[model samples]
Target: MHITVYGDTLCAQVTATAMAQTGHQVLWCLVEPESREQLAKGRPLFREQGLDLLFADQLESGRLTMDFWEGNPQGLTDAVFLALQPGQHGLAAELTKSLASSTSTGCGVIVNQTTGPVGSAELLRDIAKQIDPRAFLVALPDLIQEGNAFQTFTRPDSILLGCEDGEGEALVRELLRPFNRRKDVIQVMSLREAEFAKLAISGILATRISYMNDMASLSESLGVDIDVVRVAMGADPRIGEAYLYPGCGFGGPGLSSNVLALVDALNERAAEPGLLERVLRTNERQKEVLFRKFWQFHQGSVAGKKVALWGVAFKPGTHRVDNAPALKVIEALWAQGVKVTAHDPRALADLGQWAQGRGELTLCDDPYEAAEGADALMLITEWKPYWSPDWQRLKRVMREPLILDGRNIYEPAFVREQGLVYRGIGR
Candidate 1:
């Protein structure tokens, strides 16, 4: 199928490449100009897993192509996927205006690849009718993240298709058939249902993380091990472990904002998600929970404390700092007049000039340098490099050997035996 993906964002490019690599003829309309020059030179715009190889192959084959024009989108394709951001979701209206003056002889179906509110599809459908009442508008939310985008796109857990008619739905089904090689990975539902499902899934996942973090705090107060409690509880087959792993907090705006959006939407309908509200509140406080522990361990004084921090990205696999708890923690520490040195394998360079100017926040080349001269060490991210440190060097260098592990990657007893005050969530 000939596919045209609208937008120049990470999701748009990844979606286009994912389709093209899987044998679809993809022409990307990159509305943003910055990405144009790079993509025009066949440059990999992202550091996703295995995308470079796939992009190279597709670009060489002329199967993957991109355009940086904002004019009327002229294309001949069986499908067009709108992967624009939330603010630019009125793509259907823009396309309708363009279609009035420009002509595209080819017939195609339009699908919303970007997640929006529950009623966004119908709004797009209405605008699409202005161009051609036959222009099919459906919802197919992309579930991929920053680092694992390409891999996830190629092997999505399931593809949810929302359509109004049998004819429009068939086009989407056939277009996405290549990705769903296994029998039935496509599930068709109403547009509203599919949109809510995406938000609902994220909300539930974030809730679990927050719930675990809350319990982890309580575990410390009660002298109970959360790992032991989690194991016993998980064996019930009802509350299996996935997002239940206690950690600092959920990354940024996406999931947590989705939870808030759900709550607001539910309230409008005179319904309430009581547990979800608590979950969000718990998670917000939990973002600071790690720092709170760190301060308490230092006897309410972070001043003059050379604290070493590891991992800046909200999660290990991604370089995104959106709603990153580490950033907030670092900023708070800096405000408190504490000496903070940090290292993130991927996010170090991307932290930008503002973070660079901070005299308190010193960026380190490696983990050991960050840990040097530190009264206390904090683990903000669960990167593999930060997991195991040379205990002898760590023991010798620091004045105060307090290891405040947020992710709980290291064994408590092992670090404790090294003459360090070891602390972790629910340990």
Candidate 2:
């Protein structure tokens, strides 16, 4: 199959690369010149695990090509994947019209992989009908994670195809057959149902995380270890273990934004408030957990102190710092006349760009360099390197041997044995 992926989002890039790998010729069109230039230089606009290599390989094979979407795009593809961002639904509709105008046969499936609000597919279909009634439209919401986007897209747990027409469903299923090899992972449904299902999944995941974080706060007050509770809870066959870890809240553009979109969707449709609003509220407070702990540990005074952070990305294996908890912690520290030295395997460059003119932020390449002369160390993101460090060296380097384990990746007893005061969430 020859497919055209519209937009420059991570989902679009991953979809293009993965489709090309599965022996399909993929044309990735980006309206943004900078993003296209980055791809032209064989680099992904953002960092994702194995994305750089996969994209490079696909481009090298000539199976995947990228260009600007400047004109009509109808005969150029057997199918079109609309992978635009949340607020780009209007642009997607416009592109669909252009594609419809150029197609002499007026045949092609438009797959909606954008994370737009519910009923978005219906709107696109209505718009397509105005141009070419023969053009098929379907909703296929993307489920790619930031750091693990390639794996998630390549080996998705399930694939949802929102199509009222049999032909459109069959076309999408054939395109996704490569990823659904282990089992029958395709779920056929109406466009509205598929859009709502995607949002509901995000809402449920966010609820679980915020629920655990809420429990972590209670456990901290009651002197209970959230880790022990988390283990026992995961043992339950009904509850399961995924998204159950308590930490400094969940960040990332997709998860957080999806929850808010769900909230807005509910508010638009109902008079009553939605539960997801509370989930968003809980996560906002949870992001400040480390700062609150640090404030208490220092007896409400942290003036003129130097703090070190191990990871600044929202999560490991990526350099995305959008709405990251570490940013909140850094802001809190800096507001109180504290200097922050942060180190991440890949996020420092982006973080530095975000922190430019913020004053008192030092981006370091080495973790040990970040720890140098720090009053305390906070493990913000649980990167693999931060999981096991030279504890003795860390203790010797810091001005004060205080460790705030935001992710609870370290054992309290072992950290304490190194003569450092260790504080973990709910432990």
Candidate 3:
């Protein structure tokens, strides 16, 4: 099959590469300057585990090709994928219309992988069918996790497919046959239902995280460990272990936007007060938990203190910092006239760009260097390297030996035994 993937999103890159690897001839149309430059220089558009090598291999094999997005689809393309970012509805619609208007018999499936409103897929489908009777628009909402996107797409637990017609469903199934080999994981549903389900999944997961943060807060007052409670809760057959860990907060382009999209839907319908709004509120407050702890530790004398941050990315294995808890914590520290030095394995470049004109932030190449002369060390993102650090060196270099474990990755007893004062989220 000849496929054309549209957009500069991570999803677009992954889909283009994965499809090409599966014996399809794919043309990836990049809209962003960075994406086009990277591909022209024979580099993967974004860094993901194993994505670079695989994408390079596909390009070398002539299975995957790169082109600029010009609101046009290739004449020989069998399927067109719109894996665009959220809120790019106009671009998505224009591309879909262009593909549908094609006079050739090559264009068949317009896979809508972009996250949008509940009725977005249906709207695209209507526009496509109105122009070309043979064109099929199906929704396969983006469910890929950033850090582990390739694995999740290749070995998905389940797949949600939204298609109203048999021809469209069959074509999409054929396209996904290479990955959907382990006992048919695709769940067929109406277009609107699939879009709503994606948002609802994010909403429920956010609820779980916020619920655990609330429990963590209460546990601190009750003199108990949230980790112990979390383990016991996971042992139950009804409650799985996913998203149960208490942390500062959860943030990313996908989860945060999906939850907010769901909230907007509720507001549009004028629904009664619900748990999702509160869930978002709790998450925002949780982002500041580490800063609050630091302030209280010094008895309102936070000004002119130096703080070291271990990580700033939203999570490990990705360089994105959108809506990351570290951003909120940094802002809080800045408001109190605190100097912050931060280090992350991959996020320093992005963190540096985000810090432009906002305030002064020192970026360190070495994690230990970030801790030098700091009053306290705050572990915002649980990057793998941050899990185990030289406690003695941290104690020696810091003006104050205080460790604020925002992710609860450190054991309270062990940290204290290192001769450093330890403060954890629900310890």
Which residue pairs does candidate 3 place in steric collision? none
Q: Which residue pairs overlap in candidate 1's backbone?
A: 252-323
Tell me each candidate's TM-score.
0.91, 0.97, 0.97
lDDT of 1 by residue, 35-122 (tens): 7776678655565547667777787899988676567665677777878765565664576445433465465677787666778877
Greater lDDT among 2 and 3 belongs to 3
Q: Which candidate do you rate higher for lDDT, 1 or 3?
A: 3
**Per-residue alpha-carbon lDDT of model 2 for 1-427, expressed as tens digits?**
8898988898898999999999998888887777867768876687787898888899999999878878667355788898988898779888877877774533468898988888889999988878777778999988888889999988989777889999888888888888899999888899999998998999999999999999999998898999999999999999999999999988888998888889998899899998888898899898888888888888988998889999999989888899999988888888898988999999998899899888768889899999999988999999998898999999889999899999999999999998899998889
Error of 2 at 108 (Å): 2.2
- Badly placed stretches (over 4 Å) of model 3 are 37-44
| C-alpha lDDT of all candidate models, in order | 0.76, 0.88, 0.90
lDDT of 2: 0.88
Ranking by lDDT: 3, 2, 1
Query: How do the residues 1-427 of candidate 3 rate in per-residue lDDT, one tens digit apiece?
Result: 9998988888998899889999999998887677767667875556776777888899899999888866556668778899988999988888878888877647878899999989999999889889887678889988888888888888888899998989989999999999999879999999999999999999999999999999999999999999999999999989989999888898889999999998898888875967899999999999999999999999999899999999998988788899999999999999999999999988888899899999999999999899999999999989888888999999999999999999999989998999999999898
